[model samples]
Target: MENMIKKIVDADNEAKAMEESALKEKEELAKKIDEETQKIYDSYMKDALETVKRNDSLEEKKAEKLWEEIQNKQKSAHIKLQSDYEQNCDKWVDAIVSRTLDTNS
Candidate 1:
C-alpha cells in the first residue's frame, strides 16, 4: 500500500508539471500571434494611404485637363463670332445705303 501511494503521487506531480508547461507555451504563442497581427494591420494602413494619394493626384490631373479644354473651346467660339461679324458687315452697309437712296428719289 505504501509503494502504491508513492507511485500515484509521483504520477500526479508529473501530470501537473506537464499542464504548467502547456500553459506557458500557450501564452507565448498568443503573444507572438498578437505581434504578427499588429504588423499586418500597420502594413495594410500604409498601403491604403498610398493608394488614396495616388488616386487624388490622378483626379487633379483630370480636372486640369478638363479646364484647359473648356478654355480652348471658349477661345474658338470667340474667334468664330468675330469672323462672322466681319464677313457680314459689308453686305449690311450696302443694303442700307441702297434702300436710303431709293427712298429719297
Candidate 2:
C-alpha cells in the first residue's frame, strides 16, 4: 500500500509539471503573435504614408501646370484687348467728334 501511494504521488507531480510547461508555452506564443501583429501594422502604415506622399506630389504638379496655363491665357487676352484699342482709337474719336458738332438735327 505504501508503494502504491508513492507511485500515485509521483504521477501527480509529473502532471503538475506538464501543466506548468503548457501554460508557459501558451504565454510565449501569445507574446510572439502580438509582436508579429505590431510589425505588420507598422509596415502597412509606412507603405500607406509613402503612397500618400507620392499622390500629393503628383497633384501639386498638376495644379501648378493648370495655374501656368491660366496665366498664359490671361496674358494673351490682355494683349489682344490692347491691340484692339490701338487699332480702333482713331475711328472712335472721329465718330464722337462728328456726333457732337452736328447741329442739323
The lDDT for every candidate, in the order shown, is 0.97, 0.97
Model 2, position 37: C-alpha lDDT score: 100
| Candidate 2 residue runs with Cα over 4 Å from true position | 93-105
Model 1 C-alpha RMSD to native: 4.4
TM-score of candidate 1 to 2 decimals: 0.68
1-105 in candidate 1: lDDT tens per residue?
999999999999999999999999999999999999999999999999999999999999999999999999999999998898799889889999999999999
Per-residue CA lDDT of candidate 2, range 1-105, in tens?
A: 999999999999999999999999999999999999999999999999999999999999999999999999999999999999899989889988889889555
Candidate 1 minimal-lDDT segment of 10 residues: 84-93
Highest TM-score: which candidate? 2
Q: Per-residue lDDT for 65 in model 1?
A: 100
Which portions of model 1 miss their true places by more than 4 Å?
86-105
Root-mean-square deviation of every model: 4.4, 2.6
